[model samples]
Target: MVISNKSNRRHFIKKAALAVGSALLLGGSLLPASVMAELGEPEKEELKFGFIKLTDMAPLAIAYEKGYFEDEGLYVTLEAQANWKVLLDGVIDGQLDGAHMLAGQPLAATIGFGTKAHIVTPLSMDLNGNGITVSNEIWEKMKAHVPMGEDGKPVHPIKADYLKPVVEEYKKEGKPFNMGMVFPVSTHNYELRYWLAAGGIHPGYYAPAKGDITGQIDADALLSVTPPPQMPATLEAGTIYGYCVGEPWNQQAVFKGIGVPVITDYEIWKDNPEKVFGMTKEFTETYPNTTVRVVKAMLRAAKWLDENDNANRMEAVKILSKSQYVGADADVIANSMTGTFEYEKGDKREVPDFNVFFRYFATYPYYSDAVWYLSQMRRWGQIAEPKSDDWYMETAKSVYRPDIYQKAAEALIEEGTLSADEFPDFATETGFRAPQSEFIDEVTFDGTKPNEYLEKFSIGLKGEEVIK
Candidate 1:
């Protein structure tokens, strides 16, 4: 939980590098000793950042609490914003220099979906830290339909299809089933949709051109926006039957005995990227070294969080339990954290990548990751028409900046703040991951083949189609 000093940044790199036994990975060219000694100073040291009450906000919390910000000669104040939009607004209006953001927020905004701004991310926060939860009534009804264990606990990573019959029942009874997620462009929205669609349920669409942004057109389950902290209260009051959101709110429901969490996004799409650290393109340009310094600190914090194979997560959960950060009780936070994610009241299972920080290059802003989000945007009709493959690639490159990430990574390596082996082979790295087939639907997603990937999905609008 400690953000090492700048001098110590170098020290930890050597220690971590040696510990990993990959010290010789950096074969000389990337960071010469001359460049290593040229650690740039922060241009604007004092700053404000914002976050929601989710556990994935831990990197920012870790950075601040551990003095990673100070280690870069930057003084920072971390504030919890009222909601996603407000937090995004703060960043857009210059009230916040940067903030922990929904991975889709910057992408959506950049593409003119909600509040249009040219926001971009140099740091992806963490991977697969969200889930969908249902009330006790829904869980009770959903259990019988779901495949169960020999021990009879309803073998999980439960599909929304289990809930689909229930939703159909509601429809047959002339009733509506509703769910809440944090935002239209949120990972929760896509995960919920993906989960539902994978189970042969139509989660609905967005016909923005028709002046319908509700996204419930031709829907079985109606999904709407509810802020993260409000998820527990809203579900408790029966305002929503179920919700898709991040921690510790899902655990908050279990603490309140109001609901059961059915599935985590890690279970939906393993190691799916979540929130990221975002600022305007102008902000990074106005202060390049400061931006890299910020990423360096965050990278260190991310590495510490994932180091020891998450041996430090228990202590991190304790830190996040503080009133200023997530503000949820320690036990509540620990439910889905600490390598065990819970479903129902007592069904906690070991899911180690539930909140990956630095391992597997989790923080790297890959163009493939950006393209996937854009594909979801297209699937959901956020983008009105069919865009060329080049459009997808170009848009991803514009928003997810691996070039900037490389500069930051290089600086850290040269300064000995991180070893060359700590990152991918920069020379051979293609900012795109190989086509992946880990989704709940078993649909292959090749970032290079977006349209073809979309064509494989049975639920989403693929190719040139539109929801009328």
Candidate 2:
């Protein structure tokens, strides 16, 4: 397998030689001829970026490996950080020019939630690349509650209600039902909480005001932070019963036969936005051309990942398997990256939309996506106090920069590398997706009316509410 993959890598590199040569030749050139003829050179050409070892960080890897960054006259060094907080702090303190970040990070930071700093994202990284997995014992207990399919396999999109009985049993036995999420303000935290709440379980709350930031107030299930790569081992060691995390950790569990991934975030909320490419707002303002160029390069990489209906994903899996990147076995990463996900050991199913890269306008950083993350932060008491709908709107506008994204997209379109139709219609785009009603609870979300949407949730703090 190693010999075969090395041969394939050499072939892949040979095939890309022409493109790489063109990029190197074009590196010194300022703006692409057609679209941004007037735009000046990138102020900073040598950059060091950071990313966690996750598959959704593929755009950064692809851009760097495929010469997209060099094509834009940018010399970039990509480094893997210790954890999310360290990554965020690196960007904050100028140690990193940018990073592949959780979608909630920029929003939470801009709103002064955790480490307060004005961070912003020009492009969303990817969508729906996460899943929830349970320890074997927990799955065994919940398996009876899950309806079986005609093939005798457990039904999918398995609602958390099945887990509810197990949690109750644990509670009845005077035990604390513990779970893990990637971070406090992560999509994992909110999605896990959303799934649990939808199933009539209170995953708990945060009271930053009272310095009780553990987020265990009024809880049935206690959730704590466990870094993504450590999740499978953590669960196997009985540190956490189940965890919500990005791939290929979930797939790792299935591969090791230690846990079963019960549901994917795709089932929790279809095509939900996941990670983003984030930098300090100061960095963008100081180097506008560099920012637009960074977006342009990543836009090209994203298109490549999703082009021809993901025919290139197998190649991507090989790139991601390198020791410097995800560092997981190629097969484990391929389990979901190649468009199928494994729940139980042998229960693999085709889920083509499992890891959306460029399709569905996933690269565009919509304000609506920002709003959803903020709503989750607010719903879980991270906000500490209630604010008006206008605040949500204003805050989202501050963090998500579609204007920068548009400049990049238009540049790509003008270069004939991408088509105008491939993007949202810039002339009429409003930066907001229409009302969506595909949640586990069938709750509708309209980005423009965040407070009203929050009011509809049976759980979570709504208007005028604060954790006491």
Candidate 3:
């Protein structure tokens, strides 16, 4: 009889496997010599990973589809979580093995921001896959203030300064100028705030200590959380005038002609770190072999993504379009993935470095990147209290584990799967990048000194400052 019961089916399969094994032994056991000598077998072979429906989640999908995970002797199930919090909680609660998480999630968690947990990341996912987009109406109001080029197209990197007048006009009408970001601790929130504050617009603050997490105190424009996929619809409903989100949603807005993408995060801050591969610190420590193998698989996938000048991006787009993956249309995902980003409806431009995955040592989880995110949190009051430079360094080291990343890269190099030249030189590698000054406002940020970095911003909380 055919067994419809799952338990019975499993039992039958187990018995069948044992019988087959016994026969094989009776028939003079034949097994190939082992090849997994350098790196031991994964402590846990089956894993369930979670991700949101954004394009930057490509590393997980690519690793699964390209057989990189299996090549590492791991059976991974990639599930799409409802949102960021859900995805994070899944990892914390042991429902998920790991996830494609925000760069700030692990840091914020370890520092007791939203959900208190010891989350850590060994890999930085793709970089520069996010953009700031505005509703067509907002664009129309702001376009008049934007300078035009010889082709009559609005000049590139259309600064939020142009939108300041539109915000003021809304203020004059007693209407709240509302905008959306993925999460409060998200890079999107900080990027949106940075662009707005750079334009002399107050994007507001988070008074978490005072129980005012609305992030709208003393605000010129009110910013709130909206899931990435809902951003375009929220704009259509007039709930928000603009949003900063990761791809294909921003590109989706351009394709649907409902909104205009104003600036990519690449323009806001060149090669900025975006998503990351996150797991609970306990999980990594308990399953060290599995964690290393997981990072190794993802590292190979990331390299494949940016390989040969993104020659594999089109195939990557197809995989991401599958219903089990990003589930966006191939064209919408391709709009940004293929090295060109459509800003205004017809203003498609070449932004080859728009979605970097492996080039420029982008895969390394630099403590400096973590420090930059923490500095923004303090600048905007998410941190609530002043912290010393050493505190910032310690917090960054706790969350962004480059030691784990280095181990994975070394294993990949030893296996001949990747070359040592493709990765950062582990011998002399420092976790910090040289001070970066390419912000929209040209503000130089020294990750080694976060409090001093906060003092550079005029619109944010500096040293010893707390929300009143």
What are the models' TM-scores? Answer: 0.92, 0.94, 0.93
lDDT of 3: 0.89
Return whichever of 1 and 2 wins on lDDT. 2
Instruction: Write model 1 residue lDDT over 1-468, tens digit each, in one string.
Output: 112134445555565556446535654433355654555667887778888878999999898778777666677778888899999999999998999999999999998998999999999989989988999999899988999889888776688778888998999999989899999999999999999999988889999888889999888889999999999899989889999999998888888889999888987898899999999989999988889889988998999899988988889999999878888899989887788877777777888888899998999999999999999999988887889999999899889987778887887787677888889888999999988888777788899989988898888788879867
Candidate 2, residues 1-468, lDDT tens digits: the string is 111122234454564576657777978332355555645679998788899999999999899888788777677788898899999999999999999999999999988888999999999989999999999999999998999989999987899999999999999999999999999989899999999999999989999999988999999999999999999999999989999999999999999999999999999999999999999999999999999999999999999999999999999999999978899999999999999999998999999999999999999899899999988888999988888888888999999999999988888887778999899999999999999999988999999999999999888999999988
Name the TM-score of candidate 3. 0.93
The per-residue C-alpha lDDT of model 2 at residue 463 equals 91
Note the residue pairs that clash in candidate 2: none
- The best candidate by TM-score is 2
lDDT of 3 by residue, 256-332 (tens): 88999999999999999999999999999999889999999999999999999999999999988888778889999
Ranking by TM-score: 2, 3, 1
Clashes of 1: 0
lDDT of 3 at 125: 95
Q: Please report, in order, the local distance difference test score of every candidate based on alpha carbons.
A: 0.86, 0.91, 0.89
Point out where model 1 deviates above 4 Å.
1-33, 36-39
Q: Weakest 10 consecutive residues, lDDT, candidate 2? A: 1-10
Clashes of each: 0, 0, 0
Clashing pairs in 3: none
